[model samples]
Target: MLTYVRWYWPNDDLWNYEELDADRWALRHVELRGSDGVFLAAASLAEVLTARDSGTVGAVAEYERRYGVVPEAPLPPPTDALEPALESVSPGEFERLWRDARRQLEQQTGI
Candidate 1:
């Protein structure tokens, strides 16, 4: 099982974090959206948290390349009223939700 959490930045940007497990709290997937609620990028939590250049272009860079502007950086782990409680979910359920989100984004953006 895994845990999913969401946070809203002050700028109205959103962050989705998937944890390894409910008890562990180690991050897995991290997704980012713009203030306009556009899907900007998705990457491993390590990638976003560490800001490490893995020598390969990441989703964030690709998004910037396609849109011609860099999206806002992932803010530090939310510790205020911005964060909501973690929701536990099975791995398969998480995958389904992720796929659905991608499909919806594609339909909305036509990309």
Candidate 2:
């Protein structure tokens, strides 16, 4: 599968500076490729208007009830010796790490 660039943004109605602190806001976006990458899909959200028209009222109900309460992203990984160990790094540096790690893995497997 191709990698994607997903990001977060505010949804306004549910979130604002008053509701959330200075560091926070409402919705987050997880963009995915569709229709030759022109059209985008968010992994966390379904198409509300389309779902309503499709007679998926149950889906809409579920969405309304569970949208903000549950996070679509994976829970934070537990710290352990075997894990990759994440940290904050710039994109350029991160890419370099990915390249180096790929080389190491390939070397180990003789790929």
Please give the TM-score that candidate 2 achieves against the real structure.
0.26
Quote each prediction's TM-score: 0.38, 0.26
TM-score, structure 1 vs. true: 0.38
Question: Candidate 2 lDDT, tens digit per residue, 1-111?
Answer: 212122322232121011111232212222222323221222123344444567765866554333223233342333545433332334454344334433543454466
* 1-111 per-residue lDDT for model 1 (tens digits): 655555445455655545454454544454556454455433344544344355555855554333223223433345655545545556675576456555654565578
Q: Pull out the clashing pairs in model 1.
A: none
Give the poorly placed runs of model 2, Cα more than 4 Å off: 1-73, 76-87
